[model samples]
Target chain A: MFGEFNLIDKYFSARQAQRKDVHLTLGDDCAIVKAPDNVRIAISTDTLVAGTHFLPEANPAWVAHKALASNLSDLAAMGATPAWVSMALTLPHIDEAWLEPFCHAFFELANYYNIQLIGGDTTKGPLSITLTVQGFVPQDKVLLRNQAKVGDWVYVTGELGDSKAGLDVILAPEKRQEPFAAELEQRHYLSTPRILAGQALLNLASAAIDISDGLISDLGHILHQSQVGVSLDVNCLPMSKELRQFAPSIQVAQQYALTSGEEYELCFTVPAQNKGTLDSALAHCGTKVTCIGQIRPQGVFELLNNGQKLDWALSGYDHFKEVK
Target chain B: MFGEFNLIDKYFSARQAQRKDVHLTLGDDCAIVKAPDNVRIAISTDTLVAGTHFLPEANPAWVAHKALASNLSDLAAMGATPAWVSMALTLPHIDEAWLEPFCHAFFELANYYNIQLIGGDTTKGPLSITLTVQGFVPQDKVLLRNQAKVGDWVYVTGELGDSKAGLDVILAPEKRQEPFAAELEQRHYLSTPRILAGQALLNLASAAIDISDGLISDLGHILHQSQVGVSLDVNCLPMSKELRQFAPSIQVAQQYALTSGEEYELCFTVPAQNKGTLDSALAHCGTKVTCIGQIRPQGVFELLNNGQKLDWALSGYDHFKEVK
Candidate 1:
């Protein structure tokens, strides 16, 4: 806290939003905000720790973007329109080089979503950032994981697994020379949170979740919550061209798609009746959509490729029990 | 995240408030809450790192209480009625022995305040707790530091410095033999958030702040924000009998009171005409109120003891420049 205000004024407070709803912003003990009437606010908190969520030596801008994007993704998964965020940032020490672009990328994303930076608590500690985001969701239109019924078609917005492939290059520099390395890295660092797709899925999709912990694992959340199972086809899983070219094989690229722990895509399930409307609803979002599976009756999860049963399997990097 | 849901269901979801405003609580991608019509929300975030904010060896219950109490203090400073909280808890590893008491104490205080635990994101990392709290306040009744004007009388609710003396016993066990040692530690570990006092002062106080970084340091915030200054008498500052008996001298006891970083007392400014109403407003809170300072003309801060204009100062543990 020794130069806390100066640091915030120099970097953070410099990025003010034209958000008129915020009555009090930074520099005060607390911030005051007004919520629009007739809407419920969806809220989520995410913490990214040095060496746990990202490498301490990683680019500050990427760290800031990833931290904010993940939280935005959480709100998106809940079909909420992003609005305001409060950050609790702990730093080992102040560094101008680090703070400049960190604030820049963070505000850049905030401005895109029209979200206001309402409150900030910066303290001295090992590097970590915890962000709490609140967004407005129409009172009657909330997407939840427990609503998918049997026979619902599982869908995902945008390609998956490219970021995992992208992360490999950052983790092992030799992968930098791999085919389409830059695009893969872009997938990892600038992963897009599917806010538009999530908002669009609110009425059409029965259940939704962000596929950060891999699709199968995250889709399992839907299965568990809804008390149903799914018959998923690996061939139907979406993949980026770069991920396919950079990965050793189509199978390996699909493997990456199945288990990469940082895709911000929305994995949702829609009934057959809404399938036609779903495509039209998402057409303007400019993000691809693919049907990956069908919800099955209770206790029946099957993996298929090209309508043929396969012994293929992929588990999360951790939490193997969740994979099944 | 292996057992994240189970942990939350066992500890957090068990402590739900009967608050009907909450649409959803823990156990989802995001929690949802609705704001009552015509009220703006007050928001704040506080991050407490082990060894930085609390000793790593401190009891889990104390850590939990201190962390939550400190955040409640921030919201109270803004004159907001506590409502909902979201926590991002990063633990080095999960231990039932540690988590049980930590969750118990956290919920005990939260339930006492009738705040809902809306959103939680638990992760694996070094121990740190970041809490974001939101409360409702009438739109026009916000008490901001910048609103204090010249001639306002400065008042603080309850005693200070005893917590600092209490911390001394915890830091060095030999001090445990000191008179009123148990009460001192209780002051440090179980400090109360002055919610009722803040709610009562909404219309009566010109400006306000929660005193955690000592009186002079926090009061300087008012001076800086209001563009005015104050003449405060240290001898008039309130002190507990326990702190007075424990300190080697009256001066030492006053020093402890002036610099303790853990007191949750509400330090506020009231216009001269509102003084009588202030006492009546805070009467039911069961806390002491003392007038120790008078606001001065712009940029003229003076510290006094008795009738003597003696130059005496105490800096924050860090941030020397913040102390006048």
Candidate 2:
């Protein structure tokens, strides 16, 4: 008996909390928001399809979390403070049981980030979720991939490869009995966006990006944009105790840290002069930072094991390319 | 030859024209946009799915146009000027031939509206497009649905039933031999958002909404929000000559105008005193304005022909209810 409009009104609209900057909120054709003059709004969008982004039978709470988390991760990578988000959700059918947890987790995360749910669409289709997040960054403090200096030290926050390992366990459940299966499963379902760390690095880090596409392929984007190269130390790549224990072998651990993705960690570059301030700035932010590489003048990205270059065959996630 | 990233880089990214207010454009995690001090940003989002929102074999150009047009219409309804848009497009396969025209028409419309393509995601899934549009409206000029007062005159701009009539032709192609079949088909595929007229009415109209879900249903929104009611005159309902000529019967034409949706026309209310000003404001906007009814204190909406009530069975488009 609950229809589309009624479902949205009863569930989604009630969760749209009031914010001071919103001139017009939900129930209107569009939401009107007041933007501060000195800051520019950073905008990003992402779409999650049922089988592609997550397992069809995945927990609805995790699906909602991941949908919003990916977009917020983009804002964090851009050194922006999230302000508002709009979600277009298409579902195959209406199920109150499924939506109860989905909206609960989504609104919980939105409140945690201090971002308002402004406006969006709901339709019936093959299950998919598209989210657009907007945030504000003060002028001259916005981070860009092309700003990495040649002498900058490359750094990453938190452990990498955990999410990828978690995904592996899910993909092949027979492997779930591994050493760190529980930790990997948790990592896959719950990856936090480094919003505070990104903001703290705004005036300190030269360039930054979120590791959705893995470290090697993502750093390649910086190299392409800045016309610079990087020498990443394979030994220095940070891996959680769980990742190290769960990975089949040392080489597999390294590959997961370098190529397996959806970790939502910050990979950033700090100029040599700012090195002294980097550790102190992020110390109290609950996230740890590690220096793992250095920017180089050459236009190539290389992973070094000790002093020798390592030949890696695996690449990061590419939708169509992986299929072929 | 083209994967997700390559296709986006080769076609979509190149067409992102530079704007003075854009701090960061494509090739980054997010796009940074500047919003002027005295203006509030208007945000809206919409999703269009092939075989649902459009024909599976519909022209890609028209598909892209309708996707953007629908979101832009939301902004227009709020009396905001469009500034930026982000699209999340999911395609089952990579077809460069279809995309060539898709990008061409999409950018053509973006440039025409002075909006920039900031950032979005391209994924592999069932064919669907979700677009989020952002615009700016001066602090004092924002239009709202709840501002209409009892005794205000209700008005509608442009023809109301054309788009739905056009859809009728498309749905039943055997009727394509009807007198206005070509015009109806064109209207269905190419409905224009009333951006200019919305802006023109910003100061003169008391309450406004774009007609997406037919006049009766959409006006019900205004009535519900404003705590008022309406008495719509069937004789005053605007219909194109082509719609009248092509309709199988007069009742069918009236039904199409009343309940057939997706017209994208502006329906608004003006206080008695501002009637002269309203006429003068919209005089040169290239779209006709018609006085259709009057707002009433009672909280009910009714349609009448020659002052007699008519019982109609059709309701507006509700995704779940309609499907059921």
Candidate 3:
């Protein structure tokens, strides 16, 4: 019997009341947030749709986590500290049962980052979630894709391919019986956004991007912006034990590592002189940083396996072609 | 042949290249925005779903306008000057015919507001559009709903009931032949967000909220936030000549004025002393302002018809109830 306004008042407004930076809350036409001095606001948005982004029957809590985490990962890639977020949630129906855990997981991540849920819309429609996250970084300190210099070392945080393999486990129920299936599924469903690691890399990284698209496609962005090519060492691509065990062969595991999307891992470049400092700073954040490649002057992206060039079987998601 | 990335690069990225505040471009994991010094970044988000927010076959250009305009209205309500926006567009298919006009209308509004589309996700799904808008307001000067004073005069900008009548004309296509139907439909399709008027009221008004919901429903927010009641004069409610001709009776027109939503006009509160100054400022903006009520200390809301209390048949949109 509760209306949309009543539901929001009960679940969301109460949670939104605790933030100091929020000048106005949910009752108004818009909420006001105070941006801090000396920091430029970093903003990013993502939409997760049923069937396209996740299975319709997927757990709502995991959906909530993935949606928020993906956006947070973007701010992390920008080396901006997480601050505020707005969610426009379109639901086919207001199922309180589903909403309880979804809000729980959403607030859990929001609390972890100390991010405020400023304002957004909730309407009846096809089930989809669009979240926009904002962060702050000193004006001169924002990490950008165009700043990667030739000769800079390329580094990525944490192991790759787990989420991709985890997705496979999700799609094939029989794979659930395999060893490490639950862990892989967890990786696929509730990937951690590297906020602390990104924060740690604020000064050490020259340019950064989150590996949501495949490594090649995402790195292509840096190359196109910085106007420099990269020689990526395929052998150096990090893979978890779960990914190795789940894949049929080493090549499959390597392919997954290279082409997986939604890994939410940071791929960044640092000058050779900052290697020691970057390693030491990232070490305290408890995330594994692997040096995967080096930036080159020529604008050609190549993958090298044991010093031999290789071709990819697939090159990440393309919405148009995928639909066809 | 054009994929999501190709479409973005060809159309979106090209247009986005012109913004100076954009620290990073569309290809990055997240775009970076620089909010100016001494200004707090005001952010708001809204989602428009086909079949719910608008007709399924509505013009894509107007859909684009409504989606962005509604969000901009929120910033206007907050007395904020818009700067950047991010869009997460969900499409069932990439119909170039639809996308061309949609982008045209969307970018046109962005240019008018001097806003930049920083970054967002685009994917194939049920057709929907969600936009997050960011604006700058001086740190000390934000207008808020909670600041309405007990003795403040309640005012609203422009005619209200036209949009509701416009919507009626739309749903009942036969009504389009009625007098002033085109104007009513125009109001319904492209409700102006009073950005200039709101900016003018920044220092003069005590509190403000944009009327997206009916006057009563939205005003309830200010009452709740400010802990003050209001006695709204039904006679003072603004209704266009088109609305009067469209309605069957005067009472119906009055009801529409009270409960019609999506007017995108500013409903504000000002002290009696600032009336002259407020009038002068609003005159410069060329927006109609009508004083309709007075804020009171007693916690009660009642509609007055020529100084006599009257019951309202409708209370505006209740999303849950409407769906059921």
The models' CA-based lDDT, in order, is 0.86, 0.84, 0.83
- Runs of candidate 3 exceeding 4 Å displacement: A16-19, A299-301, A316-324, B16-20, B316-324
The interface RMSD for candidate 1 is 0.8
Candidate number of the best lDDT: 1
Better of 1 and 3 by TM-score: 1
Model 2 compared with the native: what TM-score? 0.95
Fnat of all models, as shown:
0.83, 0.90, 0.85
Task: For candidate 2, write residues A1-324 as lDDT tens digits.
Answer: 125567878878888767788877768899889888788889999999988889888889999999899889999998899999998998878978888999999999999999999888888788899999999898778888888988899999898899989998899889888778888987886889899999999989999999888887787777767778778898998899998888769889988998867888989999999999988888878998999999987545667898899777767423212222
Please give, as one word, the docking class of candidate 3.
medium
- Each model's TM-score, in the order given? 0.96, 0.95, 0.93
RMSD of 3: 3.7
lDDT (Cα, tens digit) per residue for candidate 1, span B135-226:
99997888899988888999998898988888788888887887788888888878899998889889899999998888877887888888
Better of 1 and 2 by lDDT: 1
Each candidate's interface RMSD: 0.8, 0.7, 1.3
lDDT score for residue A269 of model 2: 97
